[model samples]
Target: MEKNKAYFVVILIQLIYTGMFLLSKAAFDVGMSTCIFVFYRQAAGTLILVPFAFITEGKDSSPLTFMTFCKIFGLSLLGITTSLNIHGIALKYTSASLAAAASNCLPAITFFMACLMRFESIKLRTSSGIAKFTGIVICMGGAATMAFFKGPELRLLLHHHLLPSHAQLNVAEGSGSGSIWVKGVFLMLLSVSCWGVWIVLQVYNS
Candidate 1:
């Protein structure tokens, strides 16, 4: 039952992320500044989590050292601020689905980073290791496909005709060159890499 609940939570988180990508793209279309969006996002997250951390763990936790504080700050900078800023910029040039597709690389990137940091072991002779390696390879391949292949256009059921004129204009403005798509892909990859680093650091600190 507990395992089932955990799986449900993971699925819920993915749904939330999907919504975030779509909603963020809409926000960008309305001329929201990426930097300002990131600033408020980080601020809000800090406000929420700080109090929760204090309430839940403050009494039980040991005092934080200067080194520990630095690590936590670095993680926040890379994971929250840098990642979200890049994501916002990328969304301006690419579709929400494209951005979400690129994000599928996150787990694979995190796995490799953890291996590099000696936090995860890989034994090629073992079945589990082989499966893990294969899955990572597949994920990387999918990310590459998303980066290079434009594929067929997916028409929405509601259609562009239903959208406001300004929204249509925004969509048209954002649509263009292969170069812009490639740039967005690179930015997303960079953002995911930063997130992967944060994951490794978080594990180390914990």
Candidate 2:
């Protein structure tokens, strides 16, 4: 039952992420400003989550020091604010699929950072180390392929027929700019790295 619950949660999380990517891309295609979209997105999350957090944990939460508060503020600025803004811009310039696929590198980036901080280690002589190294290589390769390669598009009647005419036109127009696509990929990777740093910092602080 516990295992089933975990699997269900994982599936739900994936669905949420997929919906976010698709909806954000659709909004950007319709000429929504990335900055404004991010603002609304963050505001909505705060409104929904903050009250629940207060209700659940407020009384039991430990006292926060000024230094701790400063650290939290800085981490939030670096990790959430900057990362989401860049991700929004990247989603605007690139396709939703590319942004979602590129995010697979988060574990690789986080592991590498953890090793640098001595929080984790790799011993090449061990099988688990070898597997970890191999996985990191594969993740990096996948992200690189997404960033640098653009294969021939598959134009199915179903694809075009399902989307509105304007959406179809937007799709065609969105994929035409190679330079901006490259820039967006770079920014997306940077955003992922920032998020990885955030993960590592949270672990370290805890």
Candidate 3:
């Protein structure tokens, strides 16, 4: 039952991410300002999570030091604020599907960084290590392809149009623009790299 619950939670999280990607892209298509969208998104998250965090962990947690507070502030600025801003801009120039697919690189990049930092070990002679290495290679290659190639267009999932014709056309054109797509891919990859570094840095905080 515990394992089942974990699986359910994972599935739920993926569904939520899918919805976010779709909605965010739709908003961008409809001419929403990426900066304002990111601001509202972050503000909403803070409103939802801060109260719960204060109630559950405030009393038990040690008083934060000035230096520690600075570290956290810097980390949030590097990891969350900058990353999300770049991601939102990238989403403006690329399709949500590409954004979602590129995000899968996060764990791979994190693991590679951890290994480089000596926080994780891998023995390439071992089966598991080889599999991990192979997966990472594939992920990097896929990201490169996404950045450099403008593949054939994919058919829409729904037969009926959900967005206005202009919005749909804008989305399609954005995805197909070689220069803009490359720029978006590079930004997205940079954002993922920053996030991976953030994940690694969390160890020091803990």
Candidate 4:
């Protein structure tokens, strides 16, 4: 019964997420500026949270020191601004399916970053290292497949599509009609890097 319940919850999540994906794509189809979209997201969140943060923390709260502010700014810029800007802009030049397929490599990127940080490691004699390293290689192969391969390659081999994907909308304006797919890839990579740093910082903080 518990297993069935878990499966039902998972299915529900998938259905809701799929609906969200299509809705967002529809928003993009209907025309929205990336900046406006981002602004709305931030402003709406701030509208709700700012008062809460202020009231809960207190009027004389000194949590946001210069260094703390810097960290927040850096995170917002790197993780949010750079990533979302590039992602939205890139989407304008590429297909939603393609972008979604490409972004899935993100987990592997995080795993590799974790290994680099000594949070995780590989040892040859042990099966664990070899297994993880192999998984990493496979993940890279998947990313490369999305980037370079044009056709429905490997579709027959895998039951489900192993392509790239993400949750973003509001394609950016400008750059005057060029292949921004590469730009998308670069932004995704940059976002992954930022996420890697975030994970490292989180580990350190903990």
Candidate 5:
């Protein structure tokens, strides 16, 4: 029963995440600045989290030190602000498809960062770690190829296109060459690094 409940919760979270992503992109599409959108997202989430944090950890928890609160706020700023701002700016300057593709490396990249930080073990002898490492390498190879290659042989997913979404974003309209494309890719790379660092820090914090 507990296992079933856990599985259901995972599925529910995924559905909610999809809904939120669509809503967020729509906000950005409808002439909202990414910073403002991020502000709203963080504000609303913090409001919800406050009660839950208090109810869950109010008792049996060590006294909250000022330093701890500051660190938490700092982590939130880095994770939510820097990450979202870079990603939003990147999306404006590039096709959503490429942005999505690069962003998809997030989970794998975060795990890799955790390993590099020694929060996670990187032993090839261990099947789990090796599996994770393989996934990260594959994601990186795919993303790097998409980012660096300018030749016909490397433009496969480019030609394939992303599945059309409700965002009404016509990724098909992406011009093959432009300065914005370079800027977007670079910004996404920065966002990816920040997100990975944020994940590593959170893991250690927990």
Candidate 6:
């Protein structure tokens, strides 16, 4: 039952994340500033977590040392502030699908960072290590393929066919500039790298 609940929670989170990508893109279309969006997001997150943290661990938590506070601040900067702000900017210049696809490279980035930090070990002769290595390589390959390859479009008969005039205009407007797309991709990758570093820091701090 616990395992089932965990699986359900994971699925729910994934759905929420997918919805966020779509909704964020729509918000960008309507002229929302990325800075304002990120500010509100972070503020709301803080409001939600503060009460929960106080209620759950108010008295039981140990006193935070200066180093611990610094670590937490660093984590917030890397994982929340920098990552989310850059992600919002990336979404403005790229399609939601492309942004999400680029994010799928995160596990590979995290794995490499973890190994470099000595938090993860890889034994070439061991099957588990070999499997992990292969998985990371495959993930990198898939991310690169998505970034570089634009295959033939699968045009489905939908509302676009019914309203071809409006659809064509919308399509033209939605087509982002190549340079801006490249910048967005770079920013997305940098955000993921920051996230990977945050993960390593969490492991080290733990």
How well does each candidate superpose onto the true structure, as a TM-score? 0.85, 0.88, 0.87, 0.63, 0.70, 0.84
- Once fitted onto the true fold, the runs of candidate 1 whose alpha carbons sit more than 4 angstroms away are 157-176
Give candidates' CA RMSD values in order.
2.7, 2.5, 2.6, 7.9, 5.9, 3.5
lDDT assessment of candidate 2: 0.85
Candidate 6: tens digits of C-alpha lDDT, residues 105-189: 8888998899889888888799998998899889888877776665665556546554234344357545766677778778888
Error of 5 at 191 (Å): 1.7
- Best-to-worst ranking by TM-score: 2, 3, 1, 6, 5, 4
lDDT of 2 by residue, 1-206 (tens): 88799899978987888889988987887788988998899899999999999999999999999989988998899899999998999987787778878777889999998999999999989999999999999999988887788887666754555434445545565676788888899999888989989999989877
| CA lDDT of each prediction against the hidden true structure | 0.83, 0.85, 0.84, 0.62, 0.73, 0.80
Q: Which candidate number maximizes lDDT?
A: 2
Ranking by lDDT: 2, 3, 1, 6, 5, 4
Residue runs of model 6 more than 4 Å from their true location after superposition: 151-176
Model 2 segments beyond 4 Å from truth?
A: 156-176
- Give me the overall lDDT of model 4: 0.62
* Cα error, candidate 6, residue 201 (Å): 0.6
Error of 4 at 111 (Å): 2.1
Off by over 4 Å in 5: 59-61, 95-103, 125-129, 141-177
Estimate, for each residue in 1-206, the C-alpha lDDT of model 4 and write its tens digit.
Answer: 87799899977876664554444444554577867776786788789998898788887777657877777777777667766666565554555554565455666777777877878777978898788778878877887777655563234523342222221212232443235566666665665566666656556544
lDDT of 5 by residue, 1-206 (tens): 98799899977876675565555555666677988877787799899999998899888689879989988888878887899888887766554555656767888778767777877777788898789779989998898777655443333343443422423434423554456668778898888889889988987777
Candidate 4's C-alpha runs over 4 A off are 1-25, 46-66, 152-178
Best TM-score among the predictions, by candidate number: 2
Which is better, 1 or 6, measured by TM-score? 1
